[model samples]
Structures are given as structure tokens and as C-alpha cells.
Target: MKAFPQQPTYTGFNEPSRVEADVCDLEVEGELPLDLNGTYYRVGPDPQYAPRLGSDIYFNGDGMVSMFRFKNGRVDLKSRYVRTDKFKLEQEAGHALFGAYRNPWSDDPAVQGKNRGTANTNIVFHNGQLLALKEDSPPVAMDPDTLETIGNWDFNGKLSSQTFTAHPKIDPQTGEMVCFGYSATGVDTPDIAYYVVGPTGEIVHEVWIKSPYNCMIHDFGVTRDFVIFPIVPVVSSAERAKAGRPTFGWDGTKDIYLGVMPRRGTARDVRWFRAPNQFASHVMNAFNEGSKVHIDMPRAESNMFPFFPDISGKPFDRERAAARVTRWTLDFNSKGDTFEARQMTSLVGDFPRIDDRYAMESYRHGYLCVSDLTKPYDALRGGSITGMFINCLGHIDLATGKHEEYFVGPTSTLQEPVFIPKSATAAEGEGYLAVLANRHEELRSDLLILDAQRLADGPIATVHLPVRLRQGLHGNWVPATAA
Candidate 1:
């Protein structure tokens, strides 16, 4: 077998590993907690075959699923590739057939009409089934135990939207999941579809809304009564794509649009509020204050993704872009279509995660993965595919404006930290933080289970893996009992 040439972006910490272990008994550096018993599942692009385009971006590879199963004071690691229609077709052909990252117009005619989803962005475990989710298409259902692809699921054919969201929020008050899809009808369209999935895994509600411009709305926020849709300046044009011009880019003239609507309402009820020219890819959480809405997220001055350049062919100076957690408050009582944006803290980082048990409610503390101090900020893909040498994990008190951090040193990097509660009755942040750390200098990975309440104290247990796992997008924690 010929070895695939290493793509420079895929080298270092983003390298793809073909190794799949059924059971891995990792060496623990510290004491493992007895009460922690759940599986931490993550998905990332790990292409099995070399790209036909010679070189590809980090987000263009095929989806690879990894698992860290905890049982009875022991940890077992396993991984497998998601068997998608695209993967099978490529496997049968023995080469790549897909086009550029997301421009289907660049694809070969043979696979043009086929599904373009890699299902590589996020992982979700709902109603006893695991789903590999990408924002471009319907989620591919998989067997959680064996990591085998069941098939493409469209919520029993009731999902009218062509795609689903990578970030879906499960309501704490009601066991319903609120999700939405941008460019839902087709790529480069302003169409958006909002969906609600019941606890039993059925499509409960569906509504169609359109953004003011065709933009990549990757993530949104959900309050008890409302859903917040943030439409930034990063946009796409099918005409530009067909002409071989840039498909996605930043438009400085466009102002940020926040569509605040009732969770059970339609597009006509959506009240659009305009904010400054700020861009945020992810939202932490949102809540209602009667006629007012508060949405919290990390805001950057401009589009941080340099790979997807502006249509003008001008370079985006990533050095000018830095992310800080900010809060945008929209007041309907003011009788206007404007909002107040305020910087929450001086802490700068992405992936602001709160304890899901308190989601949609008044939450207290949250955690974030910060960039490694030793490396240049622009060295890590500007801000596109982060988590490579994001060496620090931070905890913030939402009420007290207090912050604490754990630095893994300059030798290692950490992925986004996911919070798992200790028990049903445990206090907020009285749980464990499951973070996958990559020691790129040593070419190895470790799953660090840190005490959330004692975040500054460092990991309580570290499960070391034999290979360096590529940094991924998002994942979840599924308790043993839930399965």
C-alpha cells in the first residue's frame, strides 16, 4: 500500500490516524473517580483515503468517531470510521470524488447529486441512538455500542429541512431538542428551518425562516420561551462559486442580525434586531427576562476563518481578530430593532460550555478552552479549526465575575471541555470536566477528567492513549444509565 502524502495542515496535531482499537486500557496518571460512569464520544474529520484535490482543508476530511467509555473505575477507548454513502462510494472507487470543502459545483459530475454531508462536526446521543451530525445534511444514525452506521435518519421522513444543525439544545424544563438549519433548501440560499425534536426522537415542530443574507449560521441559542438566531457577515454565493471565485467570505457592510422568535412560533413572528459588525460561531446559552432576551457568546471583531476568504481576494488580518465572551441584550420594550452588546469578561477563548442540566435556565458557572500562551495566536489556523495547543482550560463564575484556570503547560494542548454533573442533586459545577488533551511534542493524547468544582487543581485522572487523536469539533457525555 502506498503511503498518503502528508498535507501540511494535517501534519502536527491535526494528523489523521487510521488506528482503531476495540478496547484500550489506558494508563491512568492519577486516581479515577468511582462515581463517573459514562461514555465521552467525539467526532472529527479523519480521511481514510488521500484527497483527489491533492491538498485539502482540516474540515474537508471524512468523519472518524472516537469513544472513551468509563465503567467501574476503569476507562476503555475505541474508535471507528462512520460508514457513509460517500465513504462507501469513495472506497469502491479507491480515490476521492468530492469537490472543495463545501462547494458542490466543484464536485465531479458522478457524485454531484449525492449527499455532501461528512457528518464530522458533532456527535449526539438521543433516544438510545448515536448520531453523527454535520450542518450540511441529515444526521447519520449509528449504533452507539459498535459505532456502526445504521443509515441516514430524517426524523422518520418528517424532517422537511435538507440539513440539520450541529448544535442542538435539549431543554431542561421539557425534554425537547431545539435545532435549526441554515441554507436548508439548498446551498447559497438564505432559507432557514427551525425544528424541535421530542424526547422520544420524533419531529414535534418545524418552521421555515430566511436570513437577511446567505451566511453560515453554525450555532444558535435557546431560552425557555425563545430561540436566538445570530446572522453575521460571513456569507456565500452560488454565482461566485460557479465562477471559481470565493464561495464564503466576510462582508464588512453587513450588520449582525439577531432573529428572536418564540420557540413555538413561525417566521412571521421572528423579530429581527440589528447589532454591531460582530461575528460569533457559537452561543453559550440564552434566557428570557420577560420582554427582554439575553444571549451570551464569544465575539470576535471580524470573521476569523482565513481559509474562506472574502470575495474581494483581500487577505483577512487574523492578528486583528480576538474572541471575548460577550453578552447581547435585546429589549423589546424599547420599541426599536436594536440591541446592547457588552463584554462580559477580559477572558478570551471559544467553546464556552455550561452545564446542560442548567441549560435554558439561569446558569451560574461555565468553562472555556483558551489558546496556548507559548504559540502565536494566528499559528492555530487563525481561529478556524482551533484546539491545537489551546493549552489552558478556564472556569468563569457568571454572577461573581470571577475566573480560574488550569494551564497544561506549553508542551500540550486541550480540546473543548465538556461538563458532566456528579449527580442529579449535585450543585452547579459540582461535577467533572472531560477534556481530551494532546501532547503534540510527545505525539500522544490523554483524556483528562478534571474536578469541575476544583478546576484550578487540575485533572483528577488522566487516561493516556497510545496515539495522538486529532482535535475535533464537538461531542457529548452519555451516562451508562441513559444508554
Candidate 2:
């Protein structure tokens, strides 16, 4: 009775796998780490039903959360769909009632005023709650042990903002979560809300500011003293939404603004630094030295998302879209409105991660999913959901300026890599990297564990999964004691 479209977004490795199962004691290719006891939680878009408009982007799918439980010397698997309002409405109707990504006008009339969040972007464990985030709405809290949807959480009704960020940074020292939301009031609004949630999961501080423009603020950075918000030109307008166009589009004419404010300061203390048009997301790490703050992230010359097309009708330039790790420096000591940016690594990739313990501090190591085009790739086997071939995992040493990589086979691509420290007090970069690899030919997936310091040595253990997980956006590792 259900037939998804045959378009590329619904075919190959991108096809929907609406499977929710609990498989105990999954098969492991190598010896599992006895001390590695925790859960790796990840969420990705997996539509529960066909789109009402006959087609939809991959990002608009329902949130499917997968967890791998590690204990003793073995691992188990459990997965479930977050019972979001959009998913519940579609389930009741036996088809999709919602129409497009962030486009409320395309939705069914009966479902007006409903929450349209997919909760498909990222998952994090904090304050004894597992939060599934989508950026467009408040976070959905799930039971960490059972993966059961508890409901939408708004900091015990203390959060007044309508939206929350997916990429929240937890301070290693204070254990506080630093996050922000753009278009906080509504779509096409320049209002941005910044919050600092204490370790007990209460919003201890809040501030509101206006962005230079209404655009996408996918991720941000936080040092001990400051919060950094980089607003690019992937903008939204009410006119575009009313006209039935995409909610957000690339605008190359506008300048990028980097707004920096004290972590505990008010909006009046915020400083806006301007830069030329560019694209950056997913903060790798950020730190400060007195009045100078440095934020590290992948920087691309133009828009990286092909789904959000150029507003000026310019074709997406793949060459300019390739991103490399770059460091942005903002000095409050200087009286200039501009910041300095310098490319740090030649390794072209995104979805960057680092030892979270070194977060908000000067760090030397980082990890990311890499696309090495010079390597062999069998495009006929399967194409990437992002339309780019991401065939490897990379590690960069900022202190030494050395780049190392572990290349997956031609028939495989990778998801974002998460770093797990070997121990609570281990030295920086002395840890294990856990990443999911999509096996195109096999139509399955594998969770790989590699030594972070020796990535070129390849996986030490591979946890095999019978089902292929469609491309996921982000995930994190939760220690057993914390979970």
C-alpha cells in the first residue's frame, strides 16, 4: 500500500529503512574493548511514510534514533523512531500530512499549528536526559536506556524560545551546555536566542540578539569567556515560503557576520565582526587567549548544500564547495569590525569533532569525515546522499600541522567520527574513534573503532549491522557512568 518515489533521494543507500528492532549481542569482527562501556547514540532522517507532495528532500524525513550499547566485552543494538508530532500525524493518517522541509504552507490544513520538527540532526546525553535535536524546534527528550520518546522538553517550561540548537557544546570544566537558536521567533526572523543550561539541565542564563540577516546558523562555538555565532548567507524569507519555494536559499550577495559576546554577558556587550560571503558550519573547537578568541571549523568558498540552491540562479560550484579546516580569529583588542581567517589544513572535509575534554580550550587534535577524490571510488555502486564521495576518516594535528587518514574501501563511505577518550584522565588525542561506514555493495553498515593517534593503522574493531542506516547527520558517545 506504500510506494516511495523512485527519485535518487529515495533510492540506493538513501532508501528508507523503516525498521525498529532490538538485536542483542551483535556480531563483532574483532575483540571488543572490555573497558569501553557506554552507548553511541545517533539519529538520522528516516521517513515513516511517503511524502504528501510525492517527493521530499532527504533532510525532511522522520527522526530514527539508533543506539549501540557496549558492556563487558560485547555490544547490543536498539533502534526506534522519535514520536514527533509530524511523525504521529502521518502515522494516524497512514501517509505524510506534512509537505516540505520547514515549509508550513505545504502542510495539510488539518495539521495547522503543529510542530514540524523532524528531530533528525543530532543526539546528546546531558543532565540525565537524551535529547534528539532538529534546530527548528525544541529538543525531544528520550529515555537513554529504552530510547522511548518522553515528549518535547523546554527546560521544564523555563525556555521561552521556540527553537533550540542541535550542536550544543558542553563545557568540560563547568559541565554547562552552551547553545543558541536562529530564527528563534519564527521563520525569516533575525532574532537569535542564546542560552547556557547548567549541569542540572536548567537554563541558568539567557540572552537575545539580532543577526545581521535571517539565515541558517547550523552550529556555533564557545570558549571559556565568549560565545561565537557565525551567520552565513543561507537565508530565509517569508516571501519565499509563501511563494511555495524552499524556506532557505543561498544568497551570495550578503556579507557573513561573526557575532561574539561574553558567555555570561548581556546582548549590549555583543560585538559583530564582518567578513565576505563564505560558508562554514560545525565548530571543531574554540578557545581564547585573553582578549583574542579562536574558533576552528571547516570553511568552504560557497554553499555546500545543493538542496538549498543559489538565490541568484547560479549553478552550485562543486570546486568551491570543497571545505577544509580553517581557524577564525577575533581580537577584541583591535578596533576593527573584521576578523582574520586562515586555512589550517589541506584535508578537505566536514562534520568535524575533537576531544570534548579539550573543548573551550586550546586543543591540538581533531577528526572528521574526508573525501579523497584521488582514491578509487565506484560511483556505479552507490552515490552519496550529499552528492559528494566521502571515502575516508581524517585526523589533524594542529600543533604539528600533520594530517593523517584512514581510507575506507572504494565501495564504502563514512559518517561523522566521534572521539572517545581512552580514560577520563588520558592525554589529549589518546583515545578511540568510533564511526559508521556504509557498505554499498553489501547494503549494510559497520561501526568502526580506530585508535585516534594512529588512524592510518585502520580499525581495531568493527561492529557489523545487518541493516544499512541511511546517511546520518551527527551523534555522540555517552559513558556508562553518565548514561
Quick one: best TM-score, which candidate?
2
For all candidates in order, the CA lDDT equals 0.83, 0.90
Q: Which tens-of-lDDT digit does each residue in 199-315 have in candidate 2?
A: 999999999999988999999989999999999999997888888888899999999988999999899999999999999877999999999999998999999999899999999
What is the TM-score of each predicted model, taking all chains together?
0.95, 0.98
The lowest-lDDT stretch of 10 consecutive residues in candidate 2 is 379-388
Look at candidate 2 and give me any clashing residue pairs.
none
Q: Alpha carbon lDDT of residue 30, candidate 1?
A: 89
Where does candidate 1 stray beyond 4 Å? 1-5, 372-389
Instruction: Compute the lDDT of residue 461 as modeled in candidate 2.
Output: 96
